[model samples]
Target: MSRKGLGLLVVCLMALCQPLPSRAAGPLITPEEAALPPPKGAVGVDRRGVTRGPKIELVSGSDIASLPTRFQLKFQTFGGATVDLASVKVLYLRTPNVDLTERLKTFLQPAGIDMPDASLPPGEHMLRVDLKDSDGRAGSTSFILKVAR
Candidate 1:
């Protein structure tokens, strides 16, 4: 190619290669701005301090109670992440004619307490469960059971 043509080509290339000035940085977000709580139903936050996604519903158990036989209260978190079941406390409320302490001892075993097995007479009872997760988040639920002879 001719020297003039090469020079023109070089000039055009240089012009094309020149970098455009970068846009000014976006407005700075202070800690106060980032400290805003997640919107209702938001599960978590993103690295850019925006809401990540929707809140996840946790499944504790299907049958929280059963017959006079042994039963278990299982739980699990859905969608977001699995949370550990740290501790569970069962509050057994006795009916007007039933023994509170004795019956509770039998019903809330296997979880943590140790009690001797005994037949419970017909009566109404209130079972309140307090569950704490590994992250220190706590939740509670209740159940009513009637034992018939």
Candidate 2:
């Protein structure tokens, strides 16, 4: 072979002999991390104070739950932005006499967050979440939950 061909062959051999760099191939946030409260033990905010609203990502919980009181739902945010605390709203509504919006806020986790004290009776309920970013952008999401006593 020509000198160019010989040089190329040697380079390829050397590359094949070298060990590849190690890179993490795991999910950014694990199930355990998602189970934690807001900030949920994961990094979301930047050095700057600005943060974008979270995009809700459902993780767990089913249409029906054996105990609404202990029913668990998992969620993750889209943007790598810290949620606006003042603009964060989580509402749990049940017909006839049930609204747990304000009450749940006190026990919310970060993206992939969970309600701290969610004890409710058997019933069908609607959960609505509204969030606002530091830039004044808004996003909303919801889900239907059926709790069984």
Candidate 3:
């Protein structure tokens, strides 16, 4: 084989050996995470500081019937500030709380998050979405995801 052809073959082999991304592997939330106790507080949108913070809107239906459901969220900033994407946090509301930011990072966007396929264990799962604005104002929102038994 030509030298260039051999190099290309080697690169393809290396790529095949790499593990697939989490999104491709399976569900984003595990059974254990879903079974944890809910956080101590009301479940809804909240804002911190006199200045308004960023907003997280759940574009998809809050009630999820089955696995591999479409998950969509939109972000909005206020008070002449922009949404601080880096400050975004997706927490599985529980006694200890599970951070799902890393798993959902790829789906995140400046305007919102769009996950064509997402899965969670069967139960009523409460998720807390928290983020800040460029001005450092904090905003939070929580919603219950009801997965069919």
CA error at residue 125 for candidate 2, angstroms: 0.6
Predicted structure 1: lDDT: 0.38
Model 2, span 1-110: residue lDDT tens? 99999999999999999987542122212234333333222322222233354556545554545432333344334455555657766554322223344555544555
TM-score, candidate 2, is 0.48
Give all candidates' CA lDDT scores: 0.38, 0.49, 0.82
Tens digits of per-residue lDDT for model 3, 6-108: 9999999999999976655246689888777777874665444564668788889888876789888999887678888899999887888899898888888
Model 2, residue pairs in steric clash = 37-109, 37-110, 38-109, 38-110, 69-119, 69-120, 75-112
TM-score of each: 0.35, 0.48, 0.74
- Local error of candidate 3 at residue 122 (angstroms): 1.0
After superposition, candidate 1 runs with Cα above 4 Å error:
1-68, 78-86, 94-119
Q: Best-fitting candidate, measured by TM-score?
A: 3
Model 3 residue-pair collision total: 0
